[model samples]
Target: MTIPSVKTILYATSLSNHTRGVFQHAIDLANVYQAKLIMLHVLKPLSDSNIMAIQSYLSEKDIQKIQNVANQETKNTMKQRLADFYQDEMAGKNLPEIEQIVVKGLSRYAIVEQANKLNADIIVMGSHNKFGRSSATTRKVIKHSGRAVFVVPTDG
Candidate 1:
């Protein structure tokens, strides 16, 4: 019998403050196994209500400008957070391949799709406490991806 080893890890983040623990888990596993780490953040598309509200108050050009600005800000925020995570948790250490990915879509589908694209061996993510142990995104990923997932408790 042959044991399977990890080669790629997908670290899915909601970009919430609670994700530090989850990211740490991913980093540790990747370093231990010398696996590539793929950091992913999925942003949900604007809801119809939100779009209608914006359209009610702003012109089409104005809405486009606002979206552009928002997109840039989100990218900047992700970069800064990635740098902070690396510095705070893994400063001056040799690690495996690391990539940052940010996309606008449903979190569950996005995470599963990205993980499949990277052929990830495992996924690490943050979860709520026992009370809300399973989030919709987490559940969906588990159900559809058919991949191993390690969910760290963010409430702790």
Candidate 2:
């Protein structure tokens, strides 16, 4: 029997308060296995109606600017969270090599796509209990992702 090796870890986050615990778990695994950690946040696309409404009020240039601003905001939030997480959870510890990215798409599809693109050996994420069951995204990722997944139980 051969054991699987984890060289790269994909940590998908919704950036909720409870995600800190899940992030810690991913960091722990990365540290133990000396794996590079990739932090991913998926931004859901705007609904067609919402897009039409915005288009009605804004020019193409203005819409592009709005999108640019939104993307920048998401990037800033991801950076701030990483800074805080490192300060609180990894103070003085040798932090693992971490790469952060934010992409727009459905959560499950984006996560699975990223795992494949990054060639991640494992996917780590939090599963919120909703009516005594895991979130749909969590369930779908596990079902669709061919890589190993480490799901931490989190509050809804």
Best by lDDT: 2
**Model 2 regions more than 4 Å off:** 129-133
Candidate 2 lDDT over residue span 1-156, tens digit each: 886788999999988777788989999999999999999999899999999999999999999998889888988998899899888879998789989888999999999999999999999988883344578998999999987999998876
| Cα lDDT for residue 41, candidate 1 | 77
TM-scores of the candidates in the order shown: 0.81, 0.93
Q: Which TM-score value belongs to model 1?
A: 0.81
Q: How much is 12 displaced in model 2, in angstroms?
A: 0.5
Query: Among these predicted structures, which one has the highest TM-score?
Result: 2
Report model 2's TM-score to 2 decimal places.
Answer: 0.93
Candidates in order have lDDT scores of 0.82, 0.90
Cα-based RMSD of candidate 1: 2.7
Candidate 1 clash pair list: none
